[model samples]
Target chain A: MRSKVWVGMVLLMVALLMISGCAKKAVRTDGDVSQAGQDAAALEAEKARRAAEIEAARLAAERDAKRLAEEARLREARNQFMNEHIYFEFDSAALTPTAVSVLKEKGAWLDKERAVNVLIEGHCDERGTNEYNLALGERRAQSAKAFLVDMGISPSRLSTVSYGEERPLDPGQNEAAWAKNRRAQFVVE
Target chain B: MNFSDNFLGGRVRRWRRGFLVLGSLLALAVAVCPSASAADYGYIDLTNPYLRKIPLAIPDFKSVSGDPATVELAREGARLASQTLDFTGYFSIINPGAFLVDPKTMGVTETDVDFKAWTGIGSELLITGLASLSGGVVDLELRLFDTVKQERLLGKRYTARQADLPRLIRRFCSEVLMLLTGNPGPFESQIVFVSGGNGQKEIYTCDFDGGNPQAFTRHGNISLAPSWSTDGLWISYTSYQRGRPDLYIRHRLENRGAVVAEKGINLNGQWVPGRFELAATLSFSGDEEIYLLSGGGKIIKRLTQQPDIDVSPTFSPDGGRMAFVSKRSGSPQIYVMDMGSGHTERLTFEGPYNTQPSWSPKGGRIAYTAMEKNRIDIRMIEIETRRIVQLTQGSGDNESPSWSPDGSLIAFSSTREGPSRIYVMTSFGTDQRRLLSLPGAQSQPDWSPNGIQ
Candidate 1:
């Protein structure tokens, strides 16, 4: 019976030791899981920072592209407005009916764009003397300017210049080319 | 004739004695025969084109200093003299290869000339020259002789720097022409015109024979309508240098130029004869009109008050009247306005497009370019009778007719060869030839009035 009692006490001690070992392993495992969770949270925060940087860079690139597109569009619009010129007959400063119609369009545009100033350049064909052409070109420019002023455009916002036969849009010595060169061009300042 | 004989030296006097003896015999023979007296003096008709050209012999010039460089220059001088005379279309040069006398052994003095040899080669005139170089100066002595009469026509000596050789030659040629035609040659003058390509036009001046072309204005802009002052010391032209059509006068010898007129559209300024006043087209009054401006760019007076385009004013030789283009008749036409009375008269009525009227120096006619059959041609009209004469026809678009200083030839621009280039022709449209073969197209040639003395 006494031996039986000692054996029971030894078995109880072994049980206590086994239970303590299990409790310690459980505590260590819980600490390891909490550390792993903190590491994963740090990794997640780093990923969020990287994603934010990428998003910012993309937005900036998109804004630059959009700005350049807008600038090109404005430039093209200005060119289109200036491309329309008023033409005249050979050695005549009288504005044709078609030329007056075109000038009306230009006048309307000038009315809307009040801040824009322009120069009216008069040109002539190579048919006459350079000096005479210069005088004729001046008359053509003045004629155009007068029509624009008559159409309610401010004369101060418009200036006149005569290029004469010095500058020709077509350098060919032909009737068709001369008809193209005899024109009044518009330049935005 | 007797004065020239007295100017002869010793050996020349000896030859003159022999010539006099022969001349006396011929005179005696002519006195006996009435028909022989008709051939005594050789007179060339200036208006006759069917006459034979005077044959001239120009031997190699002698180098008095015996220097190699002087020798080369002497030969060149002789060659240039021959070329100058040949270009006048009044003389035919006798080839040196056909010479019977040795040029080296022949002395430059008139007595040393073998008149028989020159006469044998069908030369009516003989030229002998002597050149010497000393201290960077070249001295030349030239003499012209009538081979048939054995008389010295001209004797002159010129001394200048070696660089002035061409001028010396031209002066001698002018003297020769004066002796022949009673009018001094225009070879010493210059021509100013517009020349450019690739959208850059500039004013250029060249020798009358199209030698030594130089750009006078490098404004990097349009410069045109160059006109010379009566003295040729200044050139007035229209320039866009300051971004407007204005007038500028360039002092050719001083190498400086200034804007003379900056008022609105100061284009085509022409100098009035014997005056510092300029007649130019100005648009300051909101219309093209002619105005008189002083040399200082001051507006002296307004010449035209027409409500149409009036430009390209050219003064008469007397400065009493002005001929210009006016569009008051619904088309460009030539008009004349008396400067004193301001009474204007229409001068052109035939051509629909008559412009660039250049008043002749003779004050009898006005030459201009007219449009005909869809092509431009040069034509002239008499100021008094209104008789029209077509100076150029079937040539590619001839325009801008300018008269020579002597009014014997017309210098105009034509596109006959390809590009518009300066051309020259007689008053009757003969001997049409290109004036310049420059790299770019040249136009609007205005001959200088005369050599700047």
Candidate 2:
């Protein structure tokens, strides 16, 4: 009866040792699973931050390109306005009907752009004396200015200068070149 | 006096027929003897259309001093004098290679000149010079001889620094011209013009013969309509240097300038004949008008009240009248106004366009540009007789005529050679020749008054 009791105590000790070893193995496995889950969450957060940074960079580049294109468009529009010249008859400062129509368009533009100041450069054909041509050019510019003012553009926003026969648009001495030369040009200030 | 007395007596005898005959004789006499009676010196018939250029001989000058520099200068002086006289178009220089008399043996005195030798070479006039150099100064004695008359016409001596040889030679030549013609030569004068080709117009000046071209203004901008002050110490022009069309006066010698008038469109500024005042076209009143301003550009008087353009006011030599261009008649025409009485009258009526009126220094005629047949040419009008003379025709747009101070020649700009160039011609529009062959086109030439210094 004493030997039977000693064998029962050894069996109880073996069972208790097996239960403790199983419980330790289960805790180590759970710790490793939680650590791996925390590492995956950190990597996912890093990847989302990189994607957000790339998207922000792409948006900035698009904004810059749009701004540049808008600037070029504005420059082209301004150039069109500046390039519109009013031509005159040879040795005469009197504005033609065509010149009046062109000036009307310029006046409308000027009226809308009140903040922009302009300079009217009066030019003449290379036919007369420089002094008299200067006077004629001034008269041409004044005529254009008057037309614009009559169309409701402010006089203070405009100034006139005469280049006389000194500056020719076309260097040819023919009538076609002269017709192109006798003009009133615009400059934005 | 003997010739005039005989002529007048003969005219009085011929005039006894009637008052009309007397009038005609008087007119003829006056016309024939106007310049001859004014001076005792022999005169050339400049008005004769068939008049020949006077044959003049200038041999190599004699070196009075033993210095080598003096010998070199003597040779240069003779050459310069010949060149200056030749440019006048009134004298033809005889070749030195054809000279019969040795100039070294001949002296600068009438007694020392062999008049027979000079007359033998078809020379009507002779010039002899003797030069001596000492201490960086040259003493030159010049004598002009009427070889045909075997008399000394003029004798003068000048002493100056080495660098002043050109001036000395010019002054002596001017004296020679004064003795022959009633007016001095334009050799000492300068021409102020606008030259452009480098994308900017700049004011430039050259000698009367188009030598020694120098930039008068280096503003690197558009500078135009240069006019010399009466004293020739200043030049007034319109420049865009200050970013606007303003009138600026520059000192020709000091290399300094100032904006004289910045009013609305200060276009053309010309000095009054004897005063420091300027007559310019200013649009300060909202319309272009001629105005008289002080040398500093202070407005002294408003010369015109026209609603149209009144520009390019040129003062009469006496300053009692002003001639300018006006558009009050529907086209540009020249108008003259009396300063004292304020009486204005239109001076041009023949052409549809008449502008750039430069009143003659002699005070009776006005030179201007007239447009016809889509081409422009130069024309002049007489104030008294209302006679209009066309000076140029079919010459490819000749304009901007400025008379030489003596009124013997007119310097203008023309595009006859494909590019605008400055040209000079006689008052009658003879001998039209290019003034300068510069790199770029040049225009608006104003000849300075003679004897600037």
Query: What's the TM-score of every candidate structure?
Result: 0.79, 0.80
lDDT of 2 by residue, A55-134 (tens): 88888888888888877866766787799888988778888999988888788878877899989989999776778788
Q: Report the Cα RMSD per candidate.
A: 9.5, 9.2
Q: Report the poorest 10 consecutive residues by lDDT, candidate 2 chain B.
A: B1-10
Q: What ranges in model 1 sit over 4 Å off?
A: A1-77, B1-52, B64-67, B106-112, B134-136, B255-263
Over B1-453, each residue of candidate 2 has an lDDT whose tens digit, in order, gives 001101112322222233334234433432443233223112222443213667999998899866778888999999999988887777779999999988877766767788989999999989898888888887777877778878666667777887888888888787666656656868778999999874489999999988899998888989999999988888999988886678887788986766755546888657899888888888867788888888777889898998998889998899999989998988889888999999999988886989888888877878998987787888877776566777777768898899888777899999899788999987666678998978788988998998774
What DockQ values do the models have? 0.35, 0.41
What is the C-alpha interface RMSD of model 2? 1.5
Give the per-residue lDDT digits (tens) of candidate 1, residues B26-94: 324322322222231122112323124578999998888778999999999999999877766556789
Best by TM-score: 2
Give the least accurate 10-residue stretch of model 1 chain A, judged by summed lDDT: A72-81
